[model samples]
Target: MKFKNRRAMLWHFLKGNKRFFVLSILFSGLVSLLDLINPKIIGFTVDSVIGTEETALSPYLESLILQIGGLPYLKQHIFSIALVVLFVAFLAALCRFLFRLFNSMAAEKLIKRMRDLLYEHIIYLPFSWHNQNQTGDIIQRCTSDVEVIKNFFAEHLTNLLRVVLLIVLAVYFMSGIHVGLTVLSAAFIPVIVGYSFLFHHRIGESFRKVDIMEGQLSAVAQENLTGVRVVRAFGREAYEKDRFEEMNQKYMNTWIHLMKLLSAFWASGDLIGGLQVMLVVAVGAVLTIRGAITTGEYIAFVSYNAMLTWPVRMLGRVISEMSKAGISIDRIAYILNSPVEEDPEEPVNAPLDQDICFDHVSFSYGGESPEVLKDISFTIKAGSTVGILGGTGSGKSTLMYLLDRLYNIEPDEGKITIGGVDIAQMDRRYLREHIGMVLQEPYLFSGTVADNIAITQESTEMAEVRAAAKIAALDEAIGKFGKGYETYVGERGVTLSGGQKQRVAIAQMLIRKPEIMIFDDSLSAVDAETDAKIRKALGERTDQATVILIAHRITTLMKADNIIVLDHGRIAESGTHEELLSRNGFYRRIYDLQSPEEA
Candidate 1:
């Protein structure tokens, strides 16, 4: 889904929970109205009941007072006036409670919807999008940036509404006592709000810089943790520590600078608020002395003026803090706005167990970069084993990636077809499910050995897990563990060796029983003996399925039905193992170097 603007996005997330906020606003307005009643009550008590002055109350209030028995009864039962004040306070507190309850419910729901949508969108985003983005930055957007938006809605947005209502209502009430004083007090509202807006506007770029630095800091920590093994092996602990410390120091300095500006803004607000309060107090006293307003009216006007001061100033703080949300929203929008991987409206479900052809295929990582695979054309016949041999950067794995649609082969560059059906026309999910390609660096989630093997299935049977493991030559190693198939693999299979992790990945793919399987140097971590066992098992078991093996080792591919040599992203040679050796081309030279005595 795409959002036209930040407001549109916010409104979209607020859909289901808007009713809660509506109720919250109703209660909040009631609270403000309730709060206005007490000052009036205090003024009425002081003037009409205690002093010998007539009440200047609204007709509704006067009728109610008459119902309770006139001024004579109120004067006789003075404590009843205190009781009325306490009663109004109780109602105000109740309304405030309901307001908070409803507001909290709305905020929680909003946050949940935002997080769920973000996670779902990120999961379905194209692999190319993920490749171009950093894990740490994406994590920051999903987590920290999400929290900022939550605060924006839950605190600043709601509070801004409440405070603004309070300020307006307070001014309205104060005007009932003295219009000139009320006007003078309300004039400060715009000045304070405008000042805060301008200050925050200037500081917004600073906040953005800090946010970017924070993501970088997270990236540094994530990268270090992920490559801890390498760091330890190289004894680069001190270097890594220094690097992290430097980044952390910069992050701290940026935050400190922001806090200093925040302190200045708050201090300035307090000074302005104090001046406003002084002017109201001094003017109310002058009016009282001149007999222009009663002492009771002066007291109530001062009370109402004080009410306006804080919330008016708070209006500024809220507006300033909310500016941060704009930055956070844009950051999150970058993720939500990205188009997800999509298939054709009518995707084809073509049979995968047939000739797979790469026709004049050319690919570059990015369009402008030099090609990784240039004009590569080949065909893998049905139920046949084909071996791809190449050194590093020879487009060995790139070919398999194209076939599986992990990366699309451009229409102008070429197209890959399975059973004469373009893979692009095939449902991406269906294509990937049928073609299993294990990478050189295998990643295992934190789980038991059996759990990792049966990950593809929602409900697993121990029998199937063991069968796949046995084929991958992992059953023996698993049996040796004290917990056997139930043995827990630590994060990324850190508890297991490299060879063990690769075997687990192999078993994972094997359990799916895909029609087309590609091992992209997945066996590189294992010894020759284990490699031969796994390949032999696959050869016997997968006779009816098509298999493509990618490896740098000659012995691994020597027995395949067909061998294709890749050199610098082009097809160097293609034939049976013996046929390539007879021709004495690039494949023959690689064979001679690896098996010199045999050659």
Candidate 2:
């Protein structure tokens, strides 16, 4: 995944468009050559036809003119010479158009390829990478950094080649007129290029600083928008506004400073280029007066000098802008270089049946963090219902995460098996598809209620969706809305209450009819009456599937066939509700606290 240089990395994405890019450059060279010919043609017409002397022409060109009746025919039809100039101009314009067209094709294709790769890579990255990286920062790199690279190829890189060609061709033609003046005009090129290189090298760190600041500003805006409800509930609107304004001002200041530096570089380049032009014009005038070069030759020499001036000047700016592209490329490279989660080469397709076992499994969040689940062991029999009861930070959710293989455990630590086959050997996708989990805080995409419920199934039946809604006790509440199942749930289901959102999530999972269904404190937001109804409804439908329920309510777990009570990342008790009550352990204590009358 390591690239030898930024160019190599960019080329990895752009190589597919190599033919088009090469053609663009070739057309650009042709355009430069045609442009150079116009000035020479003008000089020839001025000397041979308009001036007091006849200019020497190439033998072939001279013979062609003689065949056309020599100077007499040309003098009578002076517009013929004008027609020649128009033809050369027309060819140059055509070449310029072709160059631009091909360059655009190459640039757009490269952009599309790069964006597709980045998006695909990001989604496949391990869950831990997403947790460690800020969402806004990653978004900035994908958008702004990608744009910088696109401009580098479309404008800076192509312009660099075109400018270099112009300079080479201009100097070559000027040398034919007077070697001394060509050298004098070309001397400023090195000075301008070297100064620009040094300036760009120093400016890179500043650009990076500005880029980082912009990411921070974007993150602030993203966070504020996502948590607008929380901010309003706490009456922190003023505080949020002040925080955003401060960051925005800082971002603006950094960009202002960078722009100032760029302006300074441009002004300095203009000064040097202006002086070089003056030197060329003055020296050519002296040479013409002394008869060292013809009047026509001097005019053409000045024309070539003017042609070279802007490109050499622009060459410096292009190089400087190219330096900015390097920074952007490095930023994008960081994402591309990160390794994605690897799936087994030859995965075992184990049927999700039989017992699920956690054989002395131990896990931490990695590094020096304390273990979240320590030496845990349990088993849920096939087609049985198991309830897990625990307080906050009791490793209840962590255990389920391991079962689903969202995070893998080290081989030496322990292992989980489904149907007596090590889950690690199974394909992650296949394993997850069979295990349906409704998270504690469920997230719903912006869609209609029916759309959210049927999201797991490609082709959804309204009858089946309504049945799942009834089992989760969400049918009546949805019916109350004007649009019913078609109601649009805004971002993250913000339009729904906490309990309604949780029930919608339950309906979503129930639609899949997974082999193993897990409810991770999913009913906590609903009232006790609604909770009892949901549990009763689910009990009837999920008899054939293995079910694991994680709940804090005593009433919710007391009906379970077996129960395990967790305390501080360890199992404190395990038995049926009656057996646990007899022991008077953590389970009994929790049951008493939730149901004082029953206790």
Candidate 3:
């Protein structure tokens, strides 16, 4: 859950492809050796080309090489130095190519796993968490934030390691040429690193601002796309365009700020590196002209100094990259590791015979707002039908949500029970799986009619699917489509009429055949005749299943075995429809308001 250490994060990624890590280290180490050899080869080439008899010993390689084999061979047929030089250059290029190829593959594979894991985590997060969080913010964290981390893992992570390796190799050879110069060049890098850290602290908050801007952009994009119809219908294109431009400008400003600071870091590193090169060249050139060191030695020292600059420059770049990556990592990890819907870890089924109770249940969306549903108690025996009628915001839909355990309830409150067991004791997944829901607004995925109806590939038979469709009065509508059951619906079933979409949503639930069936104002889209037919079919099919209906129309719920009329968050009237009507109470008031004469 906690990525407290860098090595651990790296190790987690490496676990995905241990072979790649092995090759990365192997190739980098081999490349370091070849890198160290380049300067030595150049130094010898200078001596050999000039036919110099005296050879200056490398302090680093001297202990290893002269201790084993003497430099006497350099005094003889030194023509072999060219071949050695070519061999060193060849090995360096080969190792670099392999290291780059393998490290990139490793980063890509690691990122894929990370992205999937984060996506799965988001899916499991509770409704409450998502409600409080912005969709655009979550989207930005998943996309752009993850991209920065992936880029770091891909190029910069290895480059950081490569730079360190090159520094070590370059220093050993530089000390061979001139120890004083080696120390002087190496000392300036830490100051550059210190400056980079200073910049990180100064701009760390700006990176967070960039993330915020990205989220705002994402929210705007999602809104524009989802509500395109509304915007166009209202003729607000120019207004929205101006608004979008404002959002874009904010995003552009944040990006420019980050770029400016990063540019300063890059420019500073280049300036120092230029001066370092000039100083080292001046010192090395003087030694060569004074007859203390050969022209070849001087040239090799210059080459080594040039090699050393890359690592110094890499230090600046790596720190900046990692600083940004750190911010992104923390943001992403926070979301991916968040607590999710608190379902039972190991799920079990509820008893089939027990009554489903809503015991003094209460809930609120957030803040100090009054509860959406107050302390209200009710019971539905197995195989019974219950109907709820309420004005808007009277908690009709919220009541149905409790049966599916979409919202967590306090244990101290009156609890819902299936048979004798409490609903909260039952797993959230099990409760949802066993409860079928059809919302007021139906959302159909972009898939074939049959595919949408049979959401799960398992337990879906063609005959059963068609049967369910017929029960929901969707069979005739499907038949009219060009491809019938195979017809592909566009996003959210935009191709289908509102009534047809409702029927398809009903058909989907019918295929599931859950223990608790809820129609939350689901038939409001259809005309009275179609609504009646669908209700008749539902009553026939779910005779033994517990049915809960929330409706605005009197005819929709006129046949309910038990009806509860709600005012505010409490039950205002509860009885058989006729009994409530006969009492001349809240139910009658609704009947008079909605349908003066009941059909």
Put the candidates in TM-score order, highest first: 1, 2, 3
Q: For residues 1-599, what per-residue lDDT tens digits would candidate 2 score against the true structure?
A: 66777778977988779888899999998999999998898887777777756787899999999999998788788899999999999999999999999999998898888899899999988877887898867988898889899999888888998888888888898888889988898888888788877887788789879868877887788888989889999999999999999999999999999999999988987888788878888988999899888888988998998888777766766887887687789999999988887888899978886799999998888768798888888899988889999999999999998999888888988899888899999888998899999999998888999999998899989999999999999999999998899998976443998899899999999998889999999999999889989988988883488999999888877888899998888898898989999998888777777765632
Residues 1-599, model 1: lDDT tens digits = 89999999999889899999889888988998898888888888888788887867789988988998989999999999899899999999999999999989998998899999999999999888999998867987888888888889888888888888888788777888889988888898899888877887788789889978987898899989999999999999999999999999999999999999999988988898899889989988999899888878888888888777767766766787897788889999999999998899999898999999989999999946688998999999999999999999999988888888888877799988899999999899999898887878888778888888888888978999999999899999999998898888977443898999899999999888899889999898999889989988997893488989999988888888899999999999899998999998998888888864532
Question: Which wins on lDDT, candidate 1 or candidate 3?
Answer: 1
- What is the C-alpha local distance difference test score of candidate 2? 0.88
Q: Please, what are the lDDT tens digits per residue for candidate 3 over residues 37-128?
A: 77766776568544554665558866764564545564454656667778778889999899878877777777787778788889999887
C-alpha TM-scores of all predictions: 0.94, 0.93, 0.88
TM-score of 1: 0.94
Off by over 4 Å in 1: 205-260, 492-494, 596-599
Q: Which pairs in model 1 have colliding backbones?
A: none
Local error of candidate 2 at residue 354 (angstroms): 1.6
How far does residue 87 in candidate 3 sit from its true spot (Å)? 2.7
Alpha-carbon lDDT, every model? 0.88, 0.88, 0.78
Per candidate, the number of residue pairs that clash is 0, 0, 1
Which 10 consecutive residues of model 2 have the lowest summed lDDT?
A: 590-599
